[model samples]
Target: MTVDRDSLTELRDLARAFAAERDWGPFHTPKNLAMALTVEAAELAEHYQWLPTGADHELDERKREGIRHELADVLLYLIQLADQSGVDLRAAALEKMELNRLKYPADQVRGDARKYTEY
Candidate 1:
């Protein structure tokens, strides 16, 4: 999933509207958004807690839907946090991917699971 800039912008606007409609702007400080994002991420992780390494690929429809909802929650919170913090999520992700490519060069790290520092 590559989400375009327009989609991210739409998500950000939706998140902003949701917060505003609920009079949540005052409570949506960067710290609070970050904490909420972490919580949502944990919730998403919980859905896969006891699954086998490749179990996700075999999820039943109901379980897949549950995972989908959890993923949505995680994404929504992340979008809200990024919007509140004035961070461009798409750009940051791309930049980080570039940095990761440098850190974990394919030829050296191929089929390896060690940290970059270990290489």
Candidate 2:
């Protein structure tokens, strides 16, 4: 699904509902959620850990689906943590992008993989 605010809201609601149904709300604090998000991210990374660079493009359908599910899990936890913490994720993301733009101006950084500080 698209990563717009409306879609994120929908996913957030679904996540909240899923947790509510299982009485997991008490354990869904920001810290716990953040940790879970990190774990899920690690799990997602595992799918590509041993692959050579560019090998991700060769993943078959099943591996792709596995990655998709891990991504979804990471997103769900992030949405949940953002919701619980009263964060406006879209705005924060846009603001961060603007900061990155200043740090890595296109004309100077194009085709360069170096850190902004290195340049």
Candidate 3:
């Protein structure tokens, strides 16, 4: 909760400039950015695709670097999508966490993985 808001703003500005510099604004639609974000997420997941449970802890430096880049790609696309959609990503995330807390109270859902509506 102590996160600096300006840092996020900077990142958002960076995403905007990145697209603008590449003359990619026309392609940076919310839909396109969303799809790109999903693709980056899938690439990130590919690292763990066939790994056993503890495999996450055992990744080598090279694989870790690749995962880092994939995560950055996902983050950049996400910022761009939010910028295009006029959504405040950090605020939305905080709000969602509050909503989830109400939906899945720790007292009621502790150790449970089912959807809140199911329980």
Give candidates' CA RMSD values in order.
3.8, 3.6, 3.3
**Candidate 1 displacement at residue 18 in angstroms:** 1.3
lDDT of 2: 0.90
Per-residue lDDT tens digits for candidate 3, residues 1-119, read 57656677899988888778999999999899999999999999988777675275778888889899998999889888888999998899999999999999999999999999899
- Give me the displacement of residue 112 in model 3, in angstroms: 1.2
* Ordered list by lDDT, greatest first: 2, 3, 1
lDDT of each: 0.86, 0.90, 0.88
- Give one digit per residue, the lDDT tens place, for model 2 in 1-119: 76655777888889989999999999999999999999999999888876786276778788899899999999899999999999988788899999999999999999999999898
Best by lDDT: 2
> In model 1, how large is the Cα lDDT of residue 56?
59
Per-residue error for 44 in candidate 1, Å, reads 1.1
Model with the higher lDDT, candidate 2 or 3: 2
Instruction: Report lDDT (Cα) of residue 90, candidate 3.
Output: 89
Q: Each model's TM-score?
A: 0.88, 0.90, 0.90
Displacement of residue 109 (Cα, Å) in model 3 is 1.0
**Segments of candidate 2 deviating more than 4 angstroms:** 1-5, 54-56
Better of 1 and 2 by lDDT: 2
How many clashes show up in model 3?
0
Q: Candidate 1, which segments miss by more than 4 Å at Cα?
A: 1-5
